[model samples]
Target: MKLLIGNRNYSSWSMRPWLVLAHFEIPFEDEVLLLSGDGWRETLAARSPTGKVPVLIDGALVVPETIAIIEYLADLYPDKPIWPADLQQRALARAASAEMHSAFLGLRGHAPMNLRANHAGKVSADAVGQDLHRVETLWGQLLARSGGPFLFGAFTAADAMFAPLATRIRTYGLPVSDTSTAYVEAIYGLPAFQEWLALALKEPWIVDDDEIDVIQGRVARGTLA
Candidate 1:
């Protein structure tokens, strides 16, 4: 199996599956397509039908989307227990992951992921507030149900799905409750997340638009206070 990812500094979508693969100690070849210049487009086009980063190629199989890649991994390695053991818990985890995959457009658009940025005081759209509220509600519900350290008592697919959101919340200094804040901290402190951050800090390829956005005060930085 081979996993194709994008530039570590700016590709939140790419981080999702990469983190999962890393966390589970999956041994696979990595192909990083730097998301600048012309190389990424050509490489992506050849590898993915959707021409996106974070495509997982397993011999004859090609999984393009991050969620699909995660699902594929879960199916292939059920012993790893990426999802919860309980049927109801597994269902809820899937629902949360799906929600994260499809919704939260407002937050995603307003505050693009930039791990190195430190803009301390920026605000996003009204819809972003709505998205945050929904996220907090979901977090509270899941944590209440499973009593985390993680979304489902242990790090599962649901946690992987929302990991980037935790990064976004931190990057933009978005408001979150005590429970949500703790959850974000837990995610940030994960070994996989720390590894990703370390790689991101060393990366040379910076998206100029994202850098400009950070400098221009379009995106807030630092963790939620």
Candidate 2:
């Protein structure tokens, strides 16, 4: 399997499945496309129908969308516990993954992930607040039920799904409960996540569109403490 992704620093969509593959000890070669290039759109359109980052190419099959990639990889490696082993837990994990895939637009728009930049920021819009609250409740419930350092007690696909959001919370210093903070730290400490972060910090590429969101808020990213 060959995974095609965008920049390590700014591409959250690319980060999800990459982490999953890495954590599971999956043997796959990854190709990185520097985003925001002059021909970036053309590059994506040639491979992906949606013209997006993180396209998985397995043999002749092309898989777009992070959730789809996860599903494909999980099915291919049923021996591996991609999702939870338990039926009920697997269902909840899938639900959580789907929710993470579609929800949180406001948080995403206002708090773009930039591993290199450390700034405290806040979103003034009510929609962002609603998303934030949803995250707190959603995460709090999952953690309480699982009794976990991870959403499902172990690092499953559900953990991969929310990994970027964990980065976003830390990147923007978003207000989250102690439970959520602990969950973020658990993800941060994962060997795969640490590897990803180390690679992200070394990248010199910059996307102006992603970086410009930082100026929209005056809140300090990590200085509020």
Candidate 3:
């Protein structure tokens, strides 16, 4: 299987399935498609059905979209505990993942997942407060229910789904509950996540659209030193 991803520094969607594949020790190769620069959109359009990263290519089957790729991984590796073993818990996890797929626009918009930059106190609380409240409530409920270092007590696909959110929380200095903070730390501590972070820090490419400082006029594009 070959997973086509975007730049590690800025592609939140790419991070999800890559974490799953790496965490589960699944045998697969990953190819990086630069998310910006000349004709990058055309490149993605030609390669992906949805013109997005995190596309899973397994033989003739092509899976686009983050949640779909994760579902495919879970189906392909049922024994690997991609989702919780309990049926109800699995349903809840899927629900949360779906919410992550659709909701949280306020936070996501104000705080794009730039792993390299630290823009603490830059994002206005008013802009993302409601979204952060929802995230805290959801994370708190699940962590309490699971008694977790992760959402479901183990690093499931649900955690992978929200992994970039965890990065955003820290990168933007978003206020969250203690439970959420610990969960964020747990995500950062994961071996798979650590691997991704190390690669992200090393990446030279920058997506100005995702860079809060660049967008806010605090810094010139491509001038990060």
Model 3 stretches with alpha carbons more than 4 Å out? none
TM-score for each candidate, following the candidate numbering = 0.91, 0.91, 0.97
Backbone clash numbers for all candidates listed: 1, 4, 0
Q: Per-residue alpha-carbon lDDT of model 1 for 50-150, expressed as tens digits? A: 98888999999988999999999999998998889999999999999999999998877777788987643564546489999999999999899878999
In terms of lDDT, the poorest run of 10 residues in model 2 is 216-225
Q: Compared to the true structure, candidate 2 yields what TM-score?
A: 0.91
What is the C-alpha lDDT profile of model 3 across 1-225, one tens digit per residue?
A: 999999999999999999999999999999999998899999999999988888999999999988888888888888899999999999999999999999999988889999998888999999999999999999999999999999999999999999999999899888888888999999999999999999999988878889898888988987865
* Candidate 2: residue 50 lDDT (0-100): 85
Q: Each prediction's Cα lDDT score?
A: 0.84, 0.86, 0.92
Prediction RMSDs, each to the true structure: 4.2, 4.2, 1.0
- Per-residue lDDT of 71-133 in model 2, one digit per residue for the tens? 999999999999999999899999999899898998888778878776565545464688889
Cα error, candidate 2, residue 140 (Å): 0.7
